[model samples]
Target chain A: MKLSKWALALGIFTSVALLAGCGSGSSNSSDGVTTVKVAWRATGKGDSMYRIYSKKWIADFEKKNPKIKISLQPINASEGDYFSKLDLAMKSADTTPDIVNEDTFILPADAKAGYLEPLDSYVAKWSDWDKFTAALKKGSQGSDGKQYGIPGTTDARGIWTDLVVTKKAGLAADWAPKSWADILTAAKKIKQTQPNVIPFAMGVSTTNGESVSMQTFEQLLYGTGETLYNEKTKKWNVNSKGILATLNFINQIYNKDKTGPSLSVVMSSNYGSTIFQDRIPKNQVGMAMDGIWNTGNWSKDGAAPIANMTKVLAFNLMPTEKGQKPGYVTMAGGWSWALPKNSKNKKAAWTVMKAMNTKQLAVTRALQEGTLTVRDDAAKDPEYLKKPFIKEATQALQNAHFRPKNDLYPKVSIAIQQMVESVAAGRKSPSDAAAKYATDVKGIVGDSNTDTQK
Target chain B: MDASNVIKNKPHKTQQQKTERRLSVWLMLPSMILLLIFFLTPMILTVVFSLTNLSLTGEAASSLHFIGFQNYLQMFKDPALATSIWNTIVFVLFSAVIGQCFFGFLIAFMMRGKNKTFRRIIGLIIIAAWVTPEVVVGFCWVAFLGDNGTLNMLAHNLLGMKPVAWLYTFPMVSIIIANVWRGTAFSMMVFQTALDDIPQEVEEAAVMDGATRWQLVTRITIPMVKGTIATNIMLVTLQTLGVFSLIYTMTGGGPENATSTLPVFMYKQAFVSYQLGYGTAISLVLLLIGALASLLYMKILKVKI
Candidate 1:
C-alpha cells in the first residue's frame, strides 16, 4: 500500500510538471515556417509610431521572407515599464520575443548579463551596416566589445515651445536662447505674463523615470560642458560643477522662481503624456525642455493631431551655459532591434530585422516616430526630411551627447535622478544633493570607479 | 458510512474499500500536485530569494548567491523604508480603521429604517464602488482630485476660490479620502449584515429603559456586535494595506515619497530599481506586520467569545 501511494505520487508530480511545461512551451516551427516574434511599443495615449510602422513592415518582411512568419508583440507601456517587462520576458526562453525593440542605453547591461545575443557576426556580412552612423553604431556595442543590436531610431533633445504662449508673453515666437540665462529670462517673462500657466516644465521627479535622467537632467548637465562619466579616466563624475549647476538650475525653476509645473504635476508618472496630450494643446504650458519625439504627437495622424503643430511650436537648440564652445547642447538616444540570448530563431529574427531597417522603412519609421534615422542613407533621404519639424530637430544632433552605454549607467542614472528629485522637491540644496549624489555613486560603483570634479 | 465499518460481514467489502480509497487518492492527486507545485514552490522560492543577493538585471542576475541578512539589515538603514512603513500605518489607521469603519457604520446606521427605494439607491451607490475595478476607481479618483480636475474646477466656479492643487499639497489626505470612499462599501455591507442579524428587541429594551440614542448605541448595540466589528476591522485593514493601484494612480508615491506605502515601496524597489532581493526583504517585513495585525485582531475577537 505504501509503495502504491508513493508510485501514484511520483506519477502525479511528473504529470503536473509536464502539464506546466506544456502551458508555457515555446512555439517553434510546426507548419514548415519558423515564426519570429517582434516586440515594440504600440499602445498608449501617446503616439503610435511603432504601430503605424509595424503594420506595414510586418507585411513587407513576411512577403520578402517566405519561410519566416513574423509575429508582432506590442508592449503598451512607458519607456521604463516597457524595458522592465522586456527584461522579465527575456529571463525565460518561452516568454522572450525573437526580436525586441531595445533602448540603446540598456543594450550594454542586457548584453553584459547574457540576456541578449551578440549580433556582430550577423552585422559584419550585411552590406548596409556601413551606412549606420558611427556614434549610433557605438550605441549598439556591448560592454564585452560585441554588437548586440542594430539602431533603428535616434533622437536629440531641445526646447519645445508653444509659439502662442511665447508670443503672448512678449517673447519672440521663434526666439533662440544663446545661453542658460536667456532661457531663464524667457521663463521669467512668461511667468510674469501668465501667472496661471506653467512657464517652463522639465521632468525632475523619480516618477518620470529615465526621462528625468536623459531629457531634463542630462540636457542641463551636458550644457554645462561637464559630463557625468569621464570617458578619459573611465570613472563616474560623481561630484562635479555640472551636476551642482544642473541641480541649482532645477532648484531655480521649480523652487525659487516657481516657474515650472507645481510639484504635484511634476511628481506624476503619467505627466509625460499629460504635458503633450493635455497641457500643451490646452496652452497650460509655455515651454518644455524635452525630446524631439513629442513633435510626432502633433502630426496629422498623431495623438493630439494639432492642425499646425510646426507653426504653433518651435524646436530650438538647447544652448550651453555661458555660451561656451559648442554653444548648443543636446542628448541623443533611441531604440534598436535586438535579439534575446534565448531566442530560438536568431537568424530568422535578424532577417526580419534587416528587412525592417531597409532605407524605405527607415524613412517611413523616421516620419512616423519623429526620430532621426540611424542609417546614413535614410537620414539623407528627402522623405525623412520633408517634415519641417524633423528638419528643425535634426539641428540638435550637431551638438548632441550620448549617454555612456555601459554596465553601470543604469545604476548611476538612479542616483542622478534622485539628486535632481531632491532639488526639485526643495528637500536638499544643490551642493548637498551633489555631495549626497557623490556618496550614492560611490556606494553603487565603489570609490575606485568614481571621481570628483569642480 | 465506510463499507468496512457498516457492512463488515461481507467478504468482498474489504476489497471494494481498498479500490474506493485508491480511486479517491487518484482523484485528489492533481489538486495536491498543483498546490505543491504552484503555491508551495513560489512561497519557498520567495523565502530563498529574500536571503540572497538577487537582482532583476545586471551582474547579480546571472549569478545569484546567498547574502544572509544583508538585505534585512539594509532595510534598517533605508530611510525610504521607514517613511513607507509610517505611511502605511497612517494610511491604514486613518483610511481603513477610522474613516471606513466610522463612515460605513454611520451610513448603515442612518439607513436602518429608511424606505425600500432609498435603501436600494444608497445600497447600489456603495456596491457600485465595490464592484468597479481598482484601476477604473483609480482613474476616476485621479480625475476627481487632480489639480486641473473636477474638484478644482467645481471649487473655482462655485466658491470663487483660486485653483488649489488638492492632490499635490495634501497627497496623503487625498489618497486617504479616496481609499475611504472606495473601501467603505465593504465595511458598510459587513456592518449592515451584522446589524440586521441583531434582534430588534435588543434595541427596543434599551429604549424602554429610557436610554438616549447615543447611550443605547454605546451600551447595548455596540457591545453586542463587538466581535463582528473586530472581524470587519481586521478584514478592511488587510484590504487597505494591499491597496497599490489606487494610490499609485493618484500620487505614484511621489512629492518625495510622501504617500509611498509598503506595497508601493516594494514595487519601486523590485520593479523600478530592479533590486529583487531587497524588495522581497521589504515584502517579508510587510508580511510580518500583517501577521501581527491578524494575531492582535484574533485576540480581540477571542476576548468577545
Candidate 2:
C-alpha cells in the first residue's frame, strides 16, 4: 500500500510538471515561424478599428514575406500605464517587443536611455524618407543629432464650439476668436444666452495629466508666444510673460468667468464622454477646447453618432493673440514607431515600419482612424483635405508648435500642468504659480541650463 | 550472549539513524533554498536599491553614494509623500477596521442562528463580489458614482434635485465603499470559522438561563471571538494598505491628491516622476508600517501557541 501511494504521488507530480512545461512551450511555438512582437495602446474606438485593419495588413504582408510572422499585442491600459509597462518590458531583451509605439514626448528620453535604436541610417537608405514633412522629421529627431523613430500620425488641438449656441449668443456660426479677450467675450455671451450650458470646457484636473498640459495649457501658452523650452539657448523656459498671461487667463476662466465645467469634471477621464456623448449631442456645452479627433466619434458608426453634428457643430482654428498673420495657434503632438535596442529582429521590424508608412497605407489609416498623417503626400491627399474638419485642423497645423523635444520635457510639462491647475483652483495667483513653476523647472533641468529668450 | 547482543545492535541501528537524519535535512533543503532565493534575495536588493540613485530614465548619477538617510530625508520633504501616508492610515483605520472587520462580525453573528438556505445565499452573494477583479469593481463603482452616473440620474430624474459629483466631492468615501464591498467577505469567513469552533453547549446554557439574545451575544460570543477578530483585523489592515488597483482606476490620487495612498504614491513617484530611489524609500517606510501593525496585533491577541 505504501509503495502504491508513493508511485501515485510521483506520477501525479510528473504529469503536472509536464503540463506546465507544455503550456509555456506551446505559447512560444504556436505558428511555427519567427513572430515579430509589437505593442501599442488601444482606446475605446481605436482598438476595434485598428485590430480589424492591422489583421488585414498583417495577412497581406505575411503572404509576401513567408518567413516572417507578426504578433500584435494590444495593451488596453491608460496612456501612462502603457508607457510604464513598455519601459519595464524593454528593460530585458527577452521581453522587449520588436517594435514599440511611443509618444513624441517620450521618444527623446527613451533614446537617451539607449532603449531605442537610432533609425537615421535606415532612413538614409530608404527611398521614401523624403515623403515625410520637415516638421515631422524634426519632431522625431533626438538631442543626440540622430533620428530615433518614424513619426506616424500628428494631431492638432482646437476649440469645438456648438454653432447653435454661438448663434444664440449673437456670434457668427463660424466664430473664430483672434485673441484671449475675444475667447472670453464669446464665452461670456454664450453663458448669458444659454444659462444651462457650459460656455467653455477646459481640463484642469490632474487625472488627465499630459492631455491637460499639452492640449489645454500649451495651446494657450503658444497662443501667447511663450514656450516650455527655448531651443536657441538649449534651456528650459518657464518665466516668460506669455506663461504668466496664460496662467491668468486659465484662472479667470475658472474663478471669474465660471464658463467651464468645475475642476473635478474637467479632470475626470470620462470628461471626453461628457463632452462627446452627453454635452455636445445634448447641446449643453457651448465650446470645448479639444482635439481634432473629436469628429472621429461623430461619424455614422461612432459611439455617439449624431447625424446633425456636421451642421450643429463647426471647427475653428484656435486663435493667436492679436490676430497674427496665421491668425491662430495650436499644440501638435504625434505618436511614433521605434525599434528597441535589444530587439533581435531589428531588420524585420524596420521593413514592417517601412510598409506601414507607405503613402497608400498612411492615407488609408489617417482617413479611417481620423489621424493627421506626418507624410506630406498623405496630408495633402484629396481624400484627407475633403473632410471639412480635417481641412481646418490642417490649416491650424501651419501655426502649431510641437512640445519641446527635450529629454526633460515630460517633467517640465507636468510642472506646467500643476502650476496651471493651482492657478485655476484659486490656490495661487498667476505670478505665484509661474514663480513656483520656474523653481520646479530649475530643479529639474538646473538653473544654468535654461534661458527664457522671449 | 554479550557478543550476539553487540552484533545485533552495532551496525544497522547507527546506519538507520544517520540515514534518517540525512533524509530529513535533504527534505528541508529545497524549501529553505527557495525561500532564500525568492524572498530574502529580493528584499535585500530592494534595501540596497533604495539607497542608490537608480532611475528608470537611466540618467547619470554618482554610483551608490551611501546617502545614509538622504532618500528618507527627501521623502519627508515631498508634499505628496506626507499626504499619501495620512491617506493610508485613514484607509486602514476606516475601511479595514470599522467597515470590514466590525461589520463582518456583526453580519456573522446575525447569520449564526438564521436558516441554512438564507445563510448560504447571503454568503454566496458577498463572496461573489469579493472574487470579482479589483479593476472591474473600481470601474463599476465609478460608473455608479460619477457626475452623470446612475446616482446622479436618480437624484435628478426621480428625486427632483441637482446632481452631485460623488467621486469628486468625496474621493475617499467612494474608494472605501468599493473596498468594503470587496473585502468584507474575507473577514466574514474568518469570523464564521471562529464562531463555528465555539462549543454550542455554552450558548445553549446561556439561553436556557433566560438570557436575552443581545446580552448572551455581547457577553459570551464577543469574548469567544476576540482573538479571531484581532487576527482578522491585522490581516485585512495589511491587505487594504497595499490596495492600488481600486484607487488607481477610480481616482488616480486626484481631485487634488484626495485619495493618494502610499502604494499609489510610490508608483507615481517611481513610474510617473521617474524618481526610483525616492519611490523605494517610500516603499521601505510602508513595509515598516505593515511590520509594526502586525507586531502590535500579535501582542494584543497573545495566542499562547
Best by DockQ: 1
Sequence-dependent TM-score of model 2: 0.87
- The TM-scores of all predictions, comma-separated, are 0.92, 0.87
Q: TM-score winner among the candidates? A: 1
- Which segments of candidate 2 are over 4 A away from where they belong? A1-33, A46-54, A239-241, A262-265, A277-284, A300-310, A321-327, A420-439, A447-454, B1-34, B58-70, B153-159, B200-220, B299-305
What are the DockQ scores of the candidates, in order?
0.32, 0.25
Q: Give all candidates' CA lDDT scores.
A: 0.83, 0.79
lDDT of 1 at B234: 88
Indicate the worst ten consecutive residues by lDDT in candidate 2 chain A: A21-30
* Model 1 steric clash pairs: none
